[model samples]
Target: MTVSVLICDDSNIARKQLKKALPEQWKESALLVNNGEEALEALQMGNFDLLFLDLTMPVMDGFQVLAAIKEQGIQVKTIVVSADLQIEARNKVAADGAIDFIRKPVSASALLDVLNTHGLL
Candidate 1:
């Protein structure tokens, strides 16, 4: 099965980096968004297998996005990818129902590991 992913990050560079790092097999199935608001909009528009979300953003933040998703009962799984590696950040995101947490500047192997762990590969 092809896994559809929504990537939310404020940095264009970060988005490009993620796009470049994702396995080529998943390229065509990925959707990139610039902020939490856009991510939420995309989620409401289509069915996605997973979400790669950044913690800090302008219009909205990852925490707010996750909370909104949970509040709306959206069922897509999410992996938090952020530069902030604070224990409290992880705990909060986890409490908000993120499936996993990945540090920023993520490597291809790390991304793959997450996908594999979630059985999305």
Candidate 2:
């Protein structure tokens, strides 16, 4: 299915890999950014349906992104994709407005499951 996706990760490989894990159309249309600042800038342009966010980065972190999205009242689905699997981290993102969380090196099946659960697939 077609979906507008914004992928924020510091690692170039991780960003591209995450894009590839999405549905074909989503993969084709995904936008990649290196940090939360870039992600926020992209989001402010307001054309994306979903955001795949990483927790740690050089400029701003995923938590900051979530907070800014909330503070700004941006309307978009967000899923935190991070290596940090700490319960606190997950709970924090959820509280900050993430719809879901996916571990790093995400499998296509896992990504697909979130999409299906949220009716994004």
Candidate 3:
């Protein structure tokens, strides 16, 4: 089965970097969103196997999006992809039901590791 991924980040550079890091095998199956609002909307409109979300954005933040997803009973898996490396922030996100945490400036190996651990690869 193809694993569909939704990438939500505010930075165009970060999005481009992540997109470049993703394995070519998954390129055709991923969707990119610029903010949490778009991510939530995309999740509502279609099914996704996983979400790579940023913590901060213009319209909505990752925490709010996550809460909304849980409130709405959406079943998609999520991972926080953020520059915030604070333990408290990580803990908060983990408490919110994220599947994993990936620090910003993500590497190809790191992306592969996350996918492998989630059994998406």
Candidate 1 lDDT trough over 10 residues, lowest sum:
18-27
Query: What tens digits encode model 1's per-residue C-alpha lDDT throughout 23-113?
Result: 8877888999999999999999999988999999999999999999999998899999999999999999999999999998988899889
The best candidate by TM-score is 2
* Count of clashes in candidate 3: 0
For each of the candidates, give the backbone clash count: 0, 0, 0
Order of all candidates by TM-score, from best down to worst? 2, 1, 3
| lDDT (Cα, 0-100) at 68 in candidate 2 | 97
lDDT tens digits, residue span 46-68, model 2: 68999999999989999999999
Question: In model 2, where do residues sit more than 4 Å from their true spots?
Answer: none
Clash pairs, candidate 1, are: none
| 78 Cα displacement, candidate 1 (Å) | 0.2
* lDDT of every model, 2 decimals: 0.91, 0.92, 0.90
Residue 80's lDDT within candidate 1 is 94
TM-score, cand. 3: 0.95
Q: What order do candidates take by lDDT, descending?
A: 2, 1, 3
RMSD of each: 0.9, 0.8, 1.0
Worst 10 residues of 2 by lDDT: 20-29
TM-scores of the models, in the order given: 0.96, 0.97, 0.95
Clashing pairs in 2: none
Candidate 1 regions with alpha-carbon error over 4 angstroms:
none
The residue-by-residue lDDT of candidate 3 on 1-121, one tens digit each, is: 5778889999999988888888787677789989999999999999998899999899999999999999999999999999999999899988888999998999999988998898877
